[model samples]
Target: MAFDVSVIIPVYQRQELAVSALRSVLEQKGVTFEVIVVDDGSPDPFVLPADLADNDRIRLLRQPNAGAAAARNTGVRATSADWIAFLDSDDLWLPGKLAGQLAFARDGLLKGWPHLTAVMCGFTQIDLPSGSRRHRIPVESWNAAELAAGCWFGPGSTALIPRNAFEQAGLFDETLMRLEDLDWFMRVGLLGGGVATWPELAVTVRVGGRPSVKMLDDAVGRMRAKWLEGGRVDGDTRRNLAAYLALEQASARRHAGRWLGFLGCMTRSLLLRPRLRVPLRRWWTEDPAAAPQ
Candidate 1:
């Protein structure tokens, strides 16, 4: 039977987590799909659990140590499905993830929500080791503007999209090495295609080493570099993208003790969105006399 969606997982050293993610996909309730695992050159020679490896729906594609973007891109190219879902190796889905997303897509189709170009679902943040302490984002409508303006995304793992849309948007930037999701999503947004999010938590996004603060900074820097590398812009998008990149830079700079840099960023933000100038004006008030705890 042909699958409705292919869940692609890019695996590195986290074999156990990858296996668990695959199991979660396999356990997806009421959904007919296949799990495609891209072993992104994991140094560890951990093999898939034999008991589950033989399953027709779970296939592994071995590749050299390409970045995660390359791995996922290869997986997308190899899968045999019109729709594709992305899952990070370390994240796990709720019991009904695929079913929920597919159902959402079907409803959108019935209601004529275009081809349902993209679908995003919410996620629960989990602390590792014990995997305890869960916090979910408050349910809210997925705002395209907010996503474009740069807000926290639980994970790229949440996206379920039409294969054709991805074809149009092109694959994740292999050179990105990180922050590829936001970069890809931003490019996808530029295409003027619609993106939707389910708002309901459908996956447990593990936040430990992979999604670290440093990783975020690195990704943002890379994204900014790429965003500008596209050359001169002739629209509101360039204005907004520059401002957003500055905001990201300012925040990073503030954390790095570059007060002047931070101010410069705040200036850009205010410049881009004049209305925000009045509200975010006092972010520089520093506390001078705090004792070491």
Candidate 2:
């Protein structure tokens, strides 16, 4: 039987959460869907969940520890469906996620929205200790320009996109450890696809402290490079990226007590990033103007 959707899940070291994610997928209603679990070289031996063990619809593939992007790409390749959705191993979905989103996509197809390439709705943010709390993005819709100027994937779990979009926009850039989804979203935005949102419940985004945060300068520098390489970024986008980068770097430097370095970053970011100009101006207006120059 042809499935309505294929849900791709990428897992790393979190096996328990992954099993729970599989259960959530099993609970989804009104859609015949397949689950593809690509384990990103977990160190522990994975015991396939009980519900998945006997089922042909559940496929588990093992690959060496590449990053999450590569793991997700592997999962997407094995799944057979027109519409592809993703839920991270640590994240999950509310029941009926597939049904509602699939219906929304099908209706758009017939309603002169042939260009619809991706549909993402709201999602819950699951706190590791607290269990779960629903979290949603403020925007209900996006166009190529809006998404390009700002980054919004609506969280990877909430996005359901056509298989064809990946074929055109290309797979996620594997080089980026951080902000890979943001990069992919920008590429989709550049390809001129209709991006519509349901503004309703979609998936649960699980947040936990696994990998410790990196140094601010290193993270921002990498993200800036990734965002630039992925899109047809205009002057405005460049400006935003630059400003963000500068602010991040300056703040990091300031915290480290490198006042001279902080001033340089603040000036560069504030100068290039007009969006931050007013706020930063007020911040530095009282201080020594000598630092920025």
The TM-score values for the models, in the order shown, are 0.78, 0.78
lDDT against the true structure, each candidate:
0.71, 0.71
TM-score: model 1 vs. ground truth: 0.78
Instruction: Write one digit per residue (lDDT tens) for candidate 2, span 268-287.
Output: 87677555343322211111
lDDT of 2: 0.71
Where model 2 places Cα greater than 4 Å from the true spot, the runs are: 114-116, 127-134, 138-142, 210-232, 244-293
Model 1 per-residue lDDT tens digits across residues 117-164: 577776666767566745443222233343345534447788888888
Instruction: Provide the lDDT at 192 for model 2.
Output: 70
